[model samples]
Target: MSSARRHILIALDMHSATDAGLSTLVSIARRLDATLSGLYIEDSQLMSAAGLPFSTEINYLSAEERILDPEELLRINRLASAQARHLLEELSARDKLECTFAVESGKVAIQSLSIQGCDVFLPGRSRKSLTRKQVTLQLRQLVLIYENSGIFERMLEVARLLAANGMVSDITIVSETPLPAEITGKLSIEDVRWHFQAVSSTRPEQLRALRLNSASLVLMPKDLLTNLTERQWFELLEQLPFPLLLMD
Candidate 1:
């Protein structure tokens, strides 16, 4: 592990509901002395389908017009960009961490794929098909979830308290497959070395077996929880002897 600052990217939608995810990113960034980048992707396809035309002029037409003028599109883009900047600025003020913002027009997954050199992607907890597809495709990428809102500071404090108590040791990064060489290479450079391990078994029984064999905390991104029924997640939580940290 190296001492380089961690680079965290938080996927933003500018919705009030995403505060939890944003806070999580802020907390981690502050604790690690990391840089936090906020990302907001404007779904161009959705805008187009909604009758907004991506043109160069603002055409104020009736609802029947069915197309957005270039001016209208530009206005909307500007608003989104301002919202993203405000979110990052607020988080930076609260967490006292270095922060930046990026607003892009494209599909979220495609935009995320193009982002390079990020330590982790922290996304809000939503049952969106696009989110699922993106996470599935980027299986090797490290991800954290924002499970709920209004607890960013608490989460950071918890992480720090855990570290002090020696509870944040021997982390197991679970997945159904091995991580790509590129991701592993980056993880290798992280300075806070804890016996970083992984379990590729997808079956519940297999995961339980592995848990019994190691005395490490089990960590999984919250997005993965959406794929499982509430009962299933609860069962795993109850059955697993070790503490489970859900990064949302």
Candidate 2:
């Protein structure tokens, strides 16, 4: 619902992979003719640990343990945030992606939910999974979970651009309900298809069976997540085997 126009969000962090992925992000943006946005999340865990009286840091260069107070953490966060924003500015400039940027403070997963008004979400990296089985994300398919038929056209339009990104093999819609007539009227895809997964009538399980995909990008509507607690969603973002995107 952001615009009749399309928008895509790309996340950034202190990691090098984040900057490395900007070209890929811009490629998708250009293909969709979508505006772009970047969100740099301040790590809440590091901040919390910094505030503890017993907090300490190990000097990676010196191999020494040192005090890591809140002040130091804040300083580190400022530098990291600035670097992230700079990268966003530089890479988004490679194309006319109509890019914008922002910064937020919280647990990364929790903080990312604050980003709004976008069509697709791309996490810049395949972050560590809590499951710890060393799973890899497959970016060859884009999975979308939509709320209603009204958003169907927007979904497919975004899907088309994403699928041609050299990695995505196709688009898949995981639906609990039948397609509304308006959507079905215009829907056709050579590779894109809808897969049915049953859910509790009152509470749909849109995120279910998602872990089966090895290295895919899974997208969902931000407003349609009715069955999960914030913590549950945060954990899902952290532990999912693939890159997860949530649209607003």
Candidate 3:
């Protein structure tokens, strides 16, 4: 686990909603007194596809088809990166929190995971979500995937802060085994209820199946996700309706 003064990294893209990730990030940063960092990603694969002579672009809102131009895509990425940096600068100035920003060209998820020196990673909503029906994320109940007492301790700290900030009343622990006494003793918060969701293991399929509607935020430790590949992590984040925070 990282120290309270560790860095919190946020992964963003052109379609990202800064408010969703930054609000949570700022809250946690203030609570932990941590520094903030932003990573703006440009999809290299999309840029390559746009370079194809026969490649075409279709408007999601309108049914119009147009030629995909790599140069235009690159320009758009630059604009998005500029906008992201501006937002981070504003956030840093407003919150008086240390902030850093970087732009990388590659697979968004892979690039984010490859970054070093970050203690915690909060990935913004997937760009694919733009085409789907939007669902409101209310922080009423939080789902935490428990691995062990050590990791759970760290997860609980953030969960508690989020619960307090979001006025969350219940927190559910999804675990393969029952919590030991050492772990259960920590769940005695006043006015906050705790529940458990049993799973066979922390496999990708089981974890995906446990996405209950009541959960507004899901917290999972990076240690428990040893079975997931980089691509799987990307897909998982893309499919989740609510945000998932991964702690190292």
lDDT, model 2: 0.59
Q: List the candidate 2 regions with Cα displacement exceeding 4 Å.
A: 1-3, 11-17, 20-23, 44-46, 55-72, 107-116, 120-138, 163-167, 180-185, 191-208, 212-215, 226-228
TM-score of 1: 0.46
TM-score, each model? 0.46, 0.68, 0.80
Q: Model 1, 1-248: lDDT tens per residue?
A: 33555566665443321444444445445655777777786767655655643423232233243344555655766786686677668978876888877777775544543566553343433322233233222222221122233332233333444454333432334445555554445333222343334455544444466633112333443334445544664455435443233333
Question: What TM-score does structure 2 among the candidates reach?
Answer: 0.68
What is the lDDT of every predicted structure here?
A: 0.47, 0.59, 0.69
Model 2: per-residue Cα lDDT over 41-122, one tens digit each = 7777778888988889786347799887898778877887787677667766766558888877765544555556665454
Q: Candidates ranked by lDDT, best first?
A: 3, 2, 1
The predicted structure with the larger TM-score, 1 or 2, is: 2
Candidate 1: where is the Cα deviation over 4 Å?
14-17, 52-81, 126-248
